[model samples]
Target: MMKIDIPTMRAQMAEGDKKRDTGLTEPTTITAIKELSYGPHGIENTFDIYYPVGTTTCLPTIVSIHGGGFFYGDKELYRFYTMYLASQGFTVVNFNYRLAPVHQYPAPLEDTNALMNWLLIHGKEHYVDTEQLFLVGDSAGGQLAEQYATLTSNPHYAGLMDFAIADVQFKAVGLNCGAYFIGQTGAINQDFPFYFGETLPEQTAQQFPVESFITTDFPPAFITTATHDFLKDVAEPLATILRSKGVEAEFHLYENPDGKELHHVFHLDQRNPIGKQCNEETLDFFRKFL
Candidate 1:
């Protein structure tokens, strides 16, 4: 496993994010609300909402989660992408959660649940159709999305976590190059402690064994990975497990046969044709659930 320097990696990503154009046009009909607090976990537990301008009618909601090896990233960094999704005629909720090495294990998960509860209570006010909700997460965030999906749909899994299964239900989920498998050897394995905290290795394994939580009730999924993405190995197996469980799922592998392959979360770069194509496909998949 590769050694990670979180600060350096974050700085690199921040620089890259600054240069990428969101490729979203004038919304002409969109409203963006920012920094809505969902809980007291910290300022990071806030979210942003975007939707059609002046629309009172309920609309499908797309809740997006950003990935940063469980140590970085926040809602602000994802604004452009989130707003672009909103301009496409859906209500989008992009949020920030407590980071690891500071907050640890279930903190992010709990923050997610609280956000859902907030949406359930306040979604109508923002014209969000609670009935038509979807989730989108990339990289480490993808792992959280998968975990949250299971906790919402699988009672047995929820019980193991010592919490009541959430009443929320997701219409579908878009997991982009997510790292679903947790255990590994090497420098990468060392990073687990930051998020899993001081929990026993066995307990940590049980808590995040995404594959074990799969069931027929799992929500439909739009899963994607790039030919060169580090997480490609797990992404395919996840989609396969979902399909095997009789859940509706689609797996897409973005490729570059003529040149170097796309990297992790390449979809964030709208300048890339392949990335743009993947985003369109993902949106189409989300629309099916609506």
Candidate 2:
């Protein structure tokens, strides 16, 4: 197991994020419904949905998996970014999942599954076009999004997880600065224990590269990373791997026109022009399927 001060790290991350999101309000163009429960874990299992204001037609839905190292993050923190997605004429769902130290591997995954199911059951209430679903995740959330999308198409993996798959197909997924080969990727390697709770056998471990579980059935992907993203290396390789498996994958590396640096998950910043471009381009990718 990786050595980590779980409580302290959580506290520190929460503080840092609070400052990062200071004064940000939900977008005026989007209407948001907050904290609707979808699972047994109460708050941790709750989700929020965003919709373009006053739209009567069923819209393409985007389920957003937030990132904070898989241990910290909630729908509230991602509200602005997701609302932007809703503003683009998609219904967006962002949820809180049970975090590590208290919950393990399948917990967060299970919560995601539950949220997807809830959406299907409540489609009319949320103005979601269940058949036109898409997913987007960044950082650790990217890992969950990938894994969950895998579970949907890979029955064997879903069985191993002992969780039922979400009963919907994703038209495509946006993986933004995601960490894929979990156990082998540096800092992400250390968080493996935080994710799975215990070690597994060699064969099972081998499948965790996230590549082994992926098949041609996986959804097409739009993978992106900033010029200076810590996980920039993960993007292209994943795209190549997906294309090799006969899945459509698009890769983009956003370079700053200025000499300034663009760090991890920079696309989440609604105010960044480049970030807006990144978001719109991803939406464009999803539009191709629709």
The numbered model that scores best in TM-score is 2
Give the C-alpha miss distance for residue 270 in model 2, angstroms.
1.5
lDDT of 1 at 168: 87
Number of colliding residue pairs in model 2: 0
Cα error, residue 40 of model 1, in Å, equals 0.3
> Candidate 2's residue-wise lDDT over 197-252, tens digit each?
56554544644767778999999999999989999988898899899999999999
TM-score of each: 0.91, 0.93
Screening candidate 2 with a backbone cut-off below 3 angstroms (N, C-alpha, C), the clashing residue pairs are none
Q: TM-score of the candidate numbered 2?
A: 0.93
Error of 1 at 278 (Å): 1.2
- State the displacement of the C-alpha of residue 110, model 1, in Å, after optimal TM-score superposition: 0.5
> Global CA lDDT of candidate 1, please?
0.83
Q: Among all windows of ten consecutive residues in candidate 2, which has the lowest summed lDDT?
A: 183-192
What lDDT is reached at residue 236 by model 1? 85
